[model samples]
Target: MKNITIIGGGLVGSLLAVLLARRGHKVDVYERRDDPRKAKPWEGRSINLVVSHRGWAALRLAGLEETVRKITVPVYARMTHDPEGRTNQLAYSIDHKANWSVSRGELNNRLLDEAERVPGVTLHFGHRCEDVDLDKATCTFSRKGAEPATSTGEVVLGCDGAFSAVRLKMQFGRFNYSQEYIEHDYKEISFPAGPDGTSLMDPNCLHIWPRRYYMLMGLANGNGSFTGTLFMPHKAVPEAPDAGFDVIRTEEQADRFLRTHFPDAYALIPNMTEQYMRHPQANLVVVRCSPWVHGATAALLGDAAHAIVPFYGEGMNAGFEDCHVLCKQLDKHGDNNWGAVLETYNAERVANGHAIADLSMRNFIEMRDLVADPRFLLRKKIEGHLQAKHPDRWMPLYSQVKFTDIPYVDALREGRRHDRIMEQVLAMPGIAEKWESEEVERKALELLDKA
Candidate 1:
């Protein structure tokens, strides 16, 4: 059996521990934070995860499907609000069932609990990875009441998130690592249940209030509450850098900002100021790296490898899929050919990660602006009509990407192709010509086959 060490106890790392342990490999998980399950009232932190096919499939493979189902609420569609307060439900699927809203803390603790219960998995909490020596296949950690310690394994997986110590040490010649900070800032707030209160919004849908430069989003929780995030461009700030309105440094300022920008939401949240002052604002960025694996000693997964903007809600889903892909490759190799498997996995996933990163960025406009645009909707209506009339010749790219298990890279390529075809279709002599063009029909069929 191979000795495996996984850093980061977040969703991806915890799931990896459970998966590898189930394969009968000895797995040790080193987490930087305290055991979240021991905390009361879910105190430490809260972040919501949008669980779609990719994430759910990973949970099932890790044997935590039933546990997650008990705590998660399904989101059937998107409840989008316009600047003028008009609301519309866009079904994620034809029958409306789409994704699940899950608490990040709850899911992490559940995965950690299940992994610790596995015979071959050891859970080490409050053990922060300080350094890694890939040449020596050793990782050092810092923990309380103990001398700095080192552990060696046949392989070390860095799921340690965007700022990874493992990736830091593995940087040698020709190792390209770059991070692009998009012009966006985000803050999160939680709205608790009132007396005999259910969720303030529809619990079965992803709620979005898109206000041009800024957008508000909410996801349901098991405790009759919703966690919402406000995403806006940092350039939305006024000219004065010290102008208190632009800065979110204090409780009073946070309240004022929320009141002025998101008036309707201000009253829905209880202790909104406290939550804002307590929890730090998270920055949105796209992190890209090349060749995620270094020989057989180490590999990077999850956000450690690709940290994408949250617009498409594919961050966690993509990470979960990473675990799924890695485990599949490991099984195929029978754990003996680690070198070959690691290289192949890295090569296959980097392209997909880049594709999702780009798509997620583009979806921001669809969410914040196009959600309310009449022209965009009219185009969608026309596209849908054509799709229905010629099912074999036309299909909306959104349906293919969101509802199916098509590889992400392929989805992105097909989306670009469809966009090009749409431009030509729109320039046709008329709607009749648009539908009757045999060349267009043939290209559309080819794209569907690719999708």
Candidate 2:
């Protein structure tokens, strides 16, 4: 068995430790933060994590599927709120398949609990990774109070997040990397439950208020509460006058803006202004890098390899798939063949990392603008209808990414092809009304055949 060191101890790193430990490897997981179980970080505020097919596949491989399911609330559709307090529902799948929502901090603590139960797994909390000796598979970690600690293993897995210290060490070598901070920033607004602990909004659907240039979203917690987020540009552009945090600097401005654009949300959140000003607006970033490995001695996984925008909600799922794929590579080439396994994994995942980064940005535009457009909604109906009638021949891009095990690279390619097919299908006269008709189906099939 190999000695493995996993840095970060976040969602992806903790899961990787469990997967590796179960396979007889000596696994050590290091976290920069305090222990979530003891600290209870999910209590006051937490962004809900959506666990889709890819994440489940990894959890299932680790035998934690049923356990993780207990903490999640199933989200089968999106409930979009309009400017006039109107609402529209878009089902994620025609047959109503769901993506599970669990608090990010809760899931992390649960995974650490599971990781700790394993005989070969050891978790080191508050041990911030300081430096790494990539060639020797060694890492130095700085604890909060005590002296710096150093550990060496046969392999170091850089599961540290986007701003990873392990990745910083990798940067000293021949690496290609780029970090892009999007124009958008976001703040969390808590939606309290009713007196009897019942959800005021539909708990089974994700709630979105798409305002063209900016948006607000809410995901349910099982206790009848919701965590709402407001995403807007950090600074307003000439084109979007009322779409930036800069426009809502004061409490009065924030209150007026919230009530005007999202009257329904403003009503639901009683102290919207208080929470809006209480929480800090966090920036979003996307980081992409090449060769997520260093000669089989060290490698990166999860956000260290690809940090994507959260619009697609596949960030954690993609990272879990990394764990799933890496474990499979070990099974294919045996545990001792680190060279072959690392090379194959890096070759396969780097392209997928880049593809998902692009896909997430595309989804951002869809969520912020197109979801509120009549034509875009019509296109989505047609895509769903086509998938219902021709399951094998047509699968919507969202389905491939969220509902199936298709790689992100393959999903992005198929999604682009679907876009081309839909463009022609939607061009047909009366397509808005005939989207469910057989003629529209035939035309779509023909276009698919030609493409």
Candidate 3:
């Protein structure tokens, strides 16, 4: 058994600790913040996450599937509400597969609890990672009102999130990294349950109000309430007209903006304006870094490796899969062979990290604008029909990403090819009225074969 040290006790770190501990490693998880179970760590920043297929596969690998499932609310479809309050529903997958909505704080706490239960696992909360010696696999941590201390292990895993200190140390090396802040910023708006504790909206479907430039999304909580997030540009550009976070400064402006663009959501959330003003407007950043591992002594995982936007809903899932991938590498090359395992892990996941980052950005466009477009809706119909007819040959890109464990790099490439093929299929005369017709299907299949 190897002595492994993990920095950050968040979702990915805690999950990695569990996986490593199960493999008989003496795992030490050092968290910067206080124990979240004692206090709500994500109280103000309550971003709800959806665990898709890859996330579940990782959890199953750690034998925590049933435990995590208890806290997730199944989301099978998306319910889009237009400005006029007219609603449309689209199933996420044709086979009735569902993604799970989980509160980030709750999930993390549960995983932390599970991690502590492992015999050789120890969790050190309130111990912030300060520095690292990459060559020696040693970390220095500091606590409030306490002297700094250093710990050494066989290997150090940096799961410390986007602004990781371990990653900071690695940045001094020949590493390549970039962080781009998206124009959009987000704030949470809570939707209370009905008087009887019943869901105010369709609990099984994710609720969306997609208004070209800005959008509001809601996911159900197990307690019958919903967590709604409004995403808007941080600053308005001369070419773009909709109000950005800069323009929506006052309570009156916030009220007007919510009432105008997301009237349905405004009606559902009682204190929309108050919550909008009270909650912090958090920016969305995408971080890309190469050479995720350093000489087998230390490596990065989860958000530390590649922090993508939340549009694709695969951020946490991708991070969880990182742990699963590393575990698989260890199994393949034996636990003691850290050199071979870390090198292979870096090679295998770096490109995938980049691919999922691109896919998430692409999905942001689809979710924010194309979701409400007539042509985009039509394309979804055509794609769904094609998949239904030719299950063996076709799977929609969304399904490939969310419903299966297909490599994200392959999925992104296939999605682009489907985009090209759909362009031709949609151009066929009368495709709007005859998308289900065999001729359209045959033409799509022929195009796929040709491509």
Candidate 4:
């Protein structure tokens, strides 16, 4: 078995360590941050995570499915709250398959605990990787009040997040990389449970307040409280002066904004203005890099390889899927063939990474604006009808992404095709009323075949 060195013992790093160790590989994980299990509950860069099919598959393969499941609440649908506080429910899947909602901190802690339990795993917290020897699979780390330390393994994996130190080292060579920061920045808001500690909103649904230019989202916590995030442009959008975080900085402006745009959320969060004003706002970034593997001696995994916007909530899931796919390549190439394994892994994942990144950006508009549109809702209803009648012939793009193991590149291709066909189907006369009619089904099926 090969020895593995993993940098960044966050969610993906810890989970990857556990997976590699299970194969009898000696795995050492070096995390920059102090041990989260011993620290105050993690409040870092968290906009609560959504673990869908791919994520669960990886966790199940790593033998932590049930343990992780205990902490997740199943989200069956999205409850959209309009500007006037009217609500609409749209199930994620026609058959009501759930996407699991989990706290990033909690998931990381549990996975770290699970990794520690494995005999072949060793976790060294506070050893921040500063430099790497890519060809030799060595990483030099700095720790508190000590000389720099180094760990060398047969293979080094970078599970560090978007702004990865390991990835920085790789760039010293001939690596291609780019980082794009979106215009929107997000702030966290807490919605405490009811006075008796029961949830104030529907715990089973992901609550969304879509205001087109900006939005608010809430996901239930295990303790009946909810973690809410407000996403808005950093500067005032030229077309909408009051829409961005820049213009909504004052407590009075925030109060009026919330009361006008997200009245339902305002009602649920009594300290809405305080939370808005006091909490730090974090920017959203999409990081894309090429040739994740460095001459077969080292590789980048998870966010280090592809950091996407959180619209689809597939960032972690895609990273988890990366681990699973890498292991699958190992199994096929045999564990010791690092050259072949890393080559195949990079070839298979890079395009898919780009595809998911684009799809996520597309979903941002869908979540922030399209969800509130009557045509968008009507289109979903028509798509649902098609799927119910012709399950083998059609599945919504959302289901393909969240409920299936299909490659993301394949999903994106199919999703675009679906969009084209749906555009035509929705333009048909009386689509809103006759969505379930045999004529509409025939039109959709015909377009699908032609496309």
Candidate 5:
């Protein structure tokens, strides 16, 4: 068995620890923060995450599928609320498959608990990674109010998130990395349960208020409460007045904004203005880096390797898939053959990382602007009908990503092809009125055949 050092101890790191330890590797997970089980790790920022097919595959591989399921609320559809509070429900999958939502902090704590139970796993909390000796597979860590220390292992895995110190260390060598902070920023808003402990919105669906230039989303917690997030541009442009977080600086401004744009949400969330003002506004960043492995001595996983926008709801799932993929590579090449395993892992996942990043960005446009559009909704109906009629030949992009174990790169390519086919299908004469007819289906199939 190999000695492994995993940095971050967050979701990906914890899962990696469990996977490696179960294989009889001596795994050490060094985290920079206090253990969430001991404290309110996510005191002000409560980000909810959805785990889809890929995430479940990894959790099941680690023997934690049923354990994680207990804490999640199943979301089977997207409930889009209009400006006037009228709503439409769109099933996420043709077969009614669902994604599971869990609080980020809660999921991490559960994984940490599972990691701790693994025999060869050791978790070091409050230990911040400072620098890395990539060639030697060693890392230097410093904790607050404590002396700095160094640790070494046969292999080092950097699951340290987007702003990773290990990645910084690798930057000194030959490495390519890019980070783009999107124009959007997000703030969390808590939606409490009813007085009698019932969900205020449909608990089985993801609630969204799409306002064209910005949007608000809510995911249910198992405890009957919902975690809401408002995504908007950080600063308003001259062309788009009152379209950014800068426009909602004051309590009255926030109150007026919510009342005007998301009145239904405003009504559901008591003290909305107070919660909006109190929560911190966080930025969304898309990070892409190359050569995920460093000569077999070290490697990057999860957000450290690729960080995409959260619109696709695949951020955590993608990270979990990283752990699963790495473990599979180890199994294929044997744990002692670090060189071959790391090389194969990097070769396979790098393209997928880039592809999912693109897909996530594309989905952001669909979520923020297109979901409420009449034509877009019609297109969805047509696609769903086509898939229902021709299940062997057609699969919606969302289902390909969220409901199947299709490689993300292939799923993304297929999604683009579907987009092209749908463009033609939607442009057919009288398609708006005849979308449900056999003629439309036949035309779509013909176009698919041609493409």
Candidate 6:
């Protein structure tokens, strides 16, 4: 049996441990944080994550889909709001295979618990990997009180996050890497149970309050509450907006902001200030690199390799897919061709990672500004018309990309193709003129089949 070490027992790493161990590999997972089964980061801190088709398939492969279904709430659509508080509901699915809304910690704990049940999987908590000696296939870790421990393994997987120590060491040893940070900054907030002991927003929809340069989103929790996050430019407030019917500060300020900006939402978030002040605001970062694998001894996956903005709600989904792809490749290649298998895994996932990264960046604008604009709505209407008129030939970009199992790179390519077709059609004098005279529809149809 292959002995493997997985660094950083976050969601991805722990899941990887279970998957590898299930295949009869001896897997040791090293985690820096305390065990999630014991306790998690903070109370009432819900990390809003979307579990799409990719994530669902990943869980199903791990044989935990039923458990996930029991714990998750489905978000069937996006409830959008304008600055003036006018609301519009956009259905993500016509058939209602909605994305799952789950708390990050809850999901992590579930995965960890399942991983512990795997006979060959051993988890070491509060033991942080200090460095890896790739040449010797050895990993050294710093434990809480004990002397540093060392483990020798056939391979090491780095599923640590964006600021991965593994990636840092690889950089020091001369691996080409590049990263880009988008201009946007987001501060998260929460809206827990209120006076009536019921949810304020629709539990069945992912609610959004898009205010041009900023947006507020909320997802349902099992506790008859909603967890909300506010995505805005760092410039939204030099300090904090004033408190009143117009502006707000402190917990009182958060209450005021919610009541004013999202009156339909204010009732749901009781003690908004407490949720705001207590919850941590995380920064988003994107990463890319060459040679994610070093021989048969080391490789990187998940945020350690490609951390993208979460606008597309594919951060965890994409990471889960990474594990899926790796496992499939490993199954195909087997242990005899380990080197080739690892390299093929890197090559196969890198482009898809880049595709999702770009899509996530584009989605930020779609969420914060384009979703609120009249022209954007008009475009969507036209796109919807095309979908209805030519069901086989045309699908809305959103439907084609997010709701399907289409590869990320393929989805991105199709989205761009449709955009070009739309550009040509919109530049024409009239819709009928463009629809009747243009060859764009025929071309787009051909591309759709290819997509």
RMSD for each of the candidates: 3.7, 1.2, 1.0, 1.1, 1.0, 3.8
Could you tell me the TM-score of candidate 1?
0.88
Candidate 1 lDDT by residue in tens digits, 261-350: 566666777677787677655677788888889887789999998999888878888898899998888878768688877988998899
Name the better of 2 and 3 by lDDT: 3
Per-residue lDDT of candidate 2, residues 37-145 (tens digit)? 8874543357987999999999999999999999999999999999999999999999889999998988998999999999999999999998899999999989888
What would the per-residue lDDT of candidate 5 be over residues 216-318, giving only the tens digit for each residue?
9999999899999999989976766787888889988888888899989989887999998889999999999999999989999999999999999998899
Alpha carbon lDDT of each predicted model: 0.78, 0.91, 0.92, 0.91, 0.92, 0.77
- TM-score (all chains, Cα) for each model: 0.88, 0.98, 0.99, 0.98, 0.99, 0.89
Residues 1-451 of candidate 3 have per-residue lDDT tens digits of 8999999999999999999999999999999999989984655589789999999999999999999999999999999999999999999988899999999989998999999999899999989999999999899999999888788898999999999898999999999999999999998888999889999899999998987788899999999999888888899766556579998889998898888878887888888899988999899999999899999789999999999999999999999999999999999999989999999999999999999999999999998888889999999998888888889999999999998889999999999999899999989999899999989989999999998
For model 1, how many clashes? 0
**Model 6 lDDT, residue 245, Cα:** 18
RMSD of 2: 1.2
Please provide, for model 6 over 1-451, each residue's C-alpha lDDT reduced to its tens digit, 9 standing for 90 to 100: 6888898888799888888888888999989888877874675445878888888888888888998888888889888966566678877744565888988888888899999999999989988889888756688889887899988888888998888877777887768888876544555677656567777667888889887655788888877677778765443454433422123346666655667776665545555556655655555678978678887778888899889998899888888888888888888999546687788898898888888888888888888777777667656766766676687767666775567778889888878877876765556566543554336456446555654
lDDT of 2 at 92: 93
Q: lDDT score of model 1?
A: 0.78
Residue 13 displacement in candidate 5 (angstroms): 0.2
Give residue 328's lDDT in candidate 3 (0 to 100).
Answer: 94
